[model samples]
Target: MTRRTSTSIGFVAVLLWALLALFTVGTAPVPPFLLNALTFALGGALGVSWVTATGGWHKLHAVPLRVYLFGTIGLFGYHALYFSALRLAPPAEASLIAYLWPLLIVLFSGLLPGERLGPLHILGACIAFSGAALIVAPGPDGFTGGIGLILAGLCALTWSGYSVLSRRLGAIPTESVAVFCLATAVLSLPAHLIFETTYWPAAPAGWLAIVGLGLGPVGLAFYVWDIGMKNGDIQLLGASSYAAPLFSTLILIVAGLADPRPSLLLAAALIAGGAGLAALGSARAQRRLIK
Candidate 1:
């Protein structure tokens, strides 16, 4: 496949990542541990079943063991921290702060071999981040939500590592990477069983939400992202992925879970404008390099 095509596909796939991320993380702290555990487990089962029926089950086992382990740990860390952040801060704050990931990617991109940023990447990063701060900092409080913002910062930074690692996965099947992540959950389950002191749910309604989460966000979403990344450009992946957060923010407002903050609208504009311009600018730069 051409570099351009891969980049475009990855951009679309990863952009949806924000919406699922907000769901998993925003709901994390408030939902009982049982809720997420069940949700993820059900999703995992459903995902595996779908894959198996399609004879794509081997995709799960196709990745290198180390890649799987890192992904698992990295993903787990994001979930745990993100949920905890929700408990500590507002969803907007948490979501906006987490959006700082592009910046994280920019910084970390330098450390990874063959992933160095061009000057345009820096300009795009600035535009993207300015938009993030606007969304997150809505209201005169100037970054209210205090410690929660800090926690979200940490969460974004952690996921940044995962994103960086993903770009480095040359020729590795996305499915293999996913299988490794699922295996990580299994590997970590024993530890969770041993140390997690949360109460168990005895009802089916609560159980449904739990399962929905894992399958929709963690399982299906990750799989989609993996496939996109394997065949796409890193810059495209980064540029277009903000759609997830934008979608989530809109959902929260529609659900009445979040009051529509005027600042949020402003943030949305910045994020959308910034990300769009950045993507376009990157395309232009790539063209210049070609010329």
Candidate 2:
């Protein structure tokens, strides 16, 4: 696919992730690791079905074992670290730190072989991060530097590193994300068993939400994201990822889970402006390449 097409597909993952908060809310009472296990299981199943239908199982065979290990670690390590961070730190602070992945991705992409980190990209990422901060910033609870904060920082690094490294593995088929999801599910099961009390979805909506999480955010998001990271405008994708939290907050407001606030309006403007700036930067780069 063209770079533009791949980037658009990658942005679709952000849109899907916007629904993550809503679905997680719907999945009330399900602990984090257990939720991870369930959603990833379904995500893996979705990938398995697609691979079988397309006779793509052979494609997976060519993939190296190390790649599998890397993918599994990336997928599972992110959630494990994030959940652990939240447990030790304030939720708002933890989330804010974890959300740094987008900014980190933009910064790290500069280190990649062909990628250039334009000023606009960095500026846009900072502005977008400020917008996200407005939403997830701590309230009366002040910051405390400890293992929790360190873990949260690592959470950001893990995801950003995973995304940036995926670009180097461009030849790796997106289908391998299926194995990543499956392996993540397997790993999550043991983590949940060890750290969490088992609890299934109590109602049908909860179950449906679990399925939605699997099919959308946890499932197809990873695949399209792989395509984008591998061949699309990585800088633009990183900068634009800030929109997931913005859209997610909007979804929560519309669902009556959150009240509309003045800060949300300002945050919306900031995020939109940042994303637009990044898009301009990406377009300029593309034009330069074509010339």
Best by TM-score: 2
Candidate 1 lDDT over 1-291, as tens digits, reads 677666665555454555554454434433433333454565467656767677875655556668767777776677666666666677765776776665566556667655556666667677778877665554665656777777788888888788777777866765554454455456556656665666543555434435556666666666666665555555556666666667767876775666687777677666656666556755775677689
**Residues 36-97, candidate 2, lDDT per residue (tens digit)?**
88989999999999888999998999999999999999988887676567556544345455
User: How far does residue 210 in candidate 2 sit from its true spot (Å)?
Assistant: 0.8
> lDDT of all the models against the reference?
0.62, 0.80
Q: Give me candidate 1's TM-score against the actual structure.
A: 0.80
Clashing pairs in 2: none
lDDT of 2 at 242: 72
Model 1 misplaced stretches (Cα beyond 4 Å): 1-5, 8-12, 25-36, 54-63, 110-116, 134-143, 187-208, 289-291
Once fitted onto the true fold, the runs of candidate 2 whose alpha carbons sit more than 4 angstroms away are: 81-98, 132-154
The true-versus-predicted C-alpha distance at residue 215 of model 1, in Å, is 2.4
TM-score list, all predictions: 0.80, 0.87
